[model samples]
Structure formats: structure tokens, C-alpha cells
Target chain A: EAGVAQSPRYKIIEKRQSVAFWCNPISGHATLYWYQQILGQGPKLLIQFQNNGVVDDSQLPKDRFSAERLKGVDSTLKIQPAKLEDSAVYLCASSLFIGGAVKQQFFGPGTRLTVL
Target chain B: DQQVKQNSPSLSVQEGRISILNCDYTNSMFDYFLWYKKYPAEGPTFLISISSIKDKNEDGRFTVFLNKSAKHLSLHIVPSQPGDSAVYFCAAGGGTGTASKLTFGTGTRLQVTL
Candidate 1:
């Protein structure tokens, strides 16, 4: 089975530039997530989507970051006016939903964004 | 207030030895725990998991032991191989309303050398 897929394994941009990362989850997976992993730190949840509907995005910085899973299969995460602090790896993950039980999330290689 | 923590940043062990990595969580709401291994430039892959109801779970040469009362968990790799050298992350899940979101520790980098 193909694992979660992401585009542009590496990205570099200048501050104030807008950058977008794409993710295509595993087929038949119903839950998708976006996470930011800074150097030396664990990945932090940026947002979660349950079949095109947002399940949680409390940690997301809505002012500069936004994500959507319109078709619920592939998703995109965008950052506008990117700052140097935004330099980090953007990871996408997906998991199968069995009834109401949540399962292990499979992750993509991730896009390493470096804002200069 | 970090919810999950891996105090040791790195560990080195000779091949064929046992490698132990520790993790602690402050949130008692966590009902499920997991361990993930990651290689450089690759995303983390699930290694093993344990539910709150179980104190220990083993897969192949990897064993995870949980101590609920102490909010501590450890991952043990026996007869460690060089391929086992990677960053290991401890993650906790399940809370009152958190759903499937996982809280992860900083990670422990283990180097298994021959």
C-alpha cells in the first residue's frame, strides 16, 4: 500500500513569501493531519481533518497558516508572509478509522521549508 | 508545560547489547502510548503501542513497558543492530476530548555501533 504522499520534499523561500505544501493521504484513510516539526523538537499538530471537516485546529496560527481538505482525499497547507521561524518540516499523516476507534497514523516524508 | 518528555537526548550502545530509552508524561489523561522510529530525512514510522489496560507489549526485539502509576514508559531493544540506530519518539494519545491527536516527546537518538 502506498503511504501518505507529500510534494516538494524540500522548499526554500524568503520571508513574506507565501508557500504551500501538498499532501495525498493513503487510499481509504478517513483522517488526515498536518504537523510542524522544528529542529530538535517533536512534531506539533497544526490541524486535523476528518473527511473534509476539521476535527481540530486549536494550535494552528490562523493569522498566517491555513489548510483545507476540500475533497477529503488530498489536502494543502499554506503559509502566507512566511517568517524565519516558519522554517521547519511540514509533515502530513493519515490513519484508518475503524468504527469509532482511532488507529496508528502513517506519515509522509515531509516537506522541509526553509524561510530565509 | 511539556506533556511528554524524553530526558535523554542521545544514547550509544554496542551491537548485540540492550538499549533502553525512557519517557515520561505529565498528562494522566493519556490512555494510549506509542513509540515511533525515524531515520534522517524520513518521517517517523510506528514501532509499537500499548493501551492503558496493558503494562507491557512486545514486538520482535522491541518491548515497551508502561508504568501508569509513575507516568513513565520505556522502550527496550535487545540484541540491538546498527539498523536500529535512529531517533525514537514517545507519543501519548487519548484524552477527554483530544480524540486521535498524539502528544510526542522530543525524542531520544540511539546509536547502535558494532
Candidate 2:
């Protein structure tokens, strides 16, 4: 089966500019997530969507970052007025949610955003 | 604060030897732990996992052990292969409504040499 897909494997933008990343999850997956991985650090959860509805986004920076999954299949994460600290890889993941069980999350190659 | 931590930055082991990676978590609410393997320029892939209800789970050459009282966990790879060189991340999940939300640690890089 095909795995999660993301676009523009790499991106570069100037500080204060805006950037957007896209993600298309695996087929039939009910849950999607966005994460940020800074250099030498593990991926940090940014937001989660369960069928186009947000499940969690407490860690997201509302002042600069936003995400949406309109059709519950593909998602987009946007950062406005990007700062140098926002330079990191943006990873997208998806999982099949079945009640209370913890499902395995499949990840995409990720978009590397470099803010100069 | 970091809820999950993999203190080792790197490890090198000869092929055919056993590799052990350790992880510690500070959150008592975490009941499920997982390990993910990642290559440079690639996203992390699920490797193995264990639930808090069990102390050990094994799959082929990989085994995961969880010590609830110590809030620690470990992943063991036996007869390690060169292809096993990658960054390994430990992640934990649990809570009332956020059971699917995972908190990850800064990974440990393992190199299997011949």
C-alpha cells in the first residue's frame, strides 16, 4: 500500500515571509497529524485531525501557525511571518483509529523549511 | 520540559552484536510506549511498541521491555545488522482524551559496524 505523501520535500523562505506545507495521508486512514522536528530533536506534535475535525492542537502556535484538513484526506499547515526559529522539518503522519486501541502511525518524507 | 528522554546521543556496535537503547519518561500518565527508526532525510518508521500492562514484548530479533515502576523502557536488537544504523526515537502516549497524542524524545543514533 502507498504511504503518506508530502509535497515540496524542501523549502526556503526569508524571515517574516509565509510558507505552507501539504500532506496527503494513506488511504482509509481516519487520523492525520502534523509535527515539527528541529535539528537533533525528535518530532514534536503540532496538531491532529480526526476526519476533518481537530482532535488536538494545544501545542500549535496560534499566532503564527495554522492547519486544516477539509476533506479528512489531505491536510495543509501554514506558517505566517516565519521566524528563524521555525526552521525545521515538517512531517505528516496518519493512522487508522479503531476505538481505544493505539494504532501505528505512518509518516511522510517531510518538508524541510529553511527560514533565512 | 521533556517528558520523554533518550539520553544517549550515539552508540556504535559491531554487526552480530546486541544493541540496547534506553529511554525514560517523566509522565505517569503515559501507558503506551513506542520506538521508531529514522534514516537521514526520511521520516520515522514504527519499529516496536509495548503497553504498560506488559513488561516485555518480543518480535523477531527486536524486543522491548517496560518497567512501570521506574518509568523506563528499553529496546533490544540482537545480532544487529549494518542496515540497522539509524536514529531511534522513543515515544509515549496516554491521558484522558489524548491517548493518540505522542510525546517523543530526542533520538539516539545507533551505528552497526562490521
TM-score for each model: 0.98, 0.97
Q: Give one digit per residue, the lDDT tens place, for model 2 in A1-116.
A: 99999998999999999999999999999899999999999999999999999989999999999999988899999999899999999999998866766467889999999999
Error at A79, model 1, angstroms: 0.1
Cα lDDT listed for each candidate = 0.93, 0.92
Question: DockQ of each candidate's interface versus the true one?
Answer: 0.61, 0.62
Which residue runs of candidate 2 sit more than 4 Å off their true CA positions?
B96-99
Mind giving the per-residue lDDT tens digits that candidate 1 earns over A1-116? Answer: 99899998999999999999999999999899999999999999999999999999999999999999988899999999899999999999998867677758899999999999
TM-score between predicted and true chain B, model 2:
0.96
- Relative to the real complex, the DockQ score for model 1 comes to 0.61
Query: How far out, in Å, is residue A61 in model 1?
Result: 0.3
- The candidate maximizing lDDT is 1
Candidate 1 wrongly placed segments (more than 4 Å): B96-99
Over the true interface residues, superposed, what is the Cα RMSD of model 2?
Answer: 2.4
Chain A (candidate 1) TM-score to true chain A: 0.98
For candidate 1 chain A, which ten residues in a row score worst on lDDT? A96-105
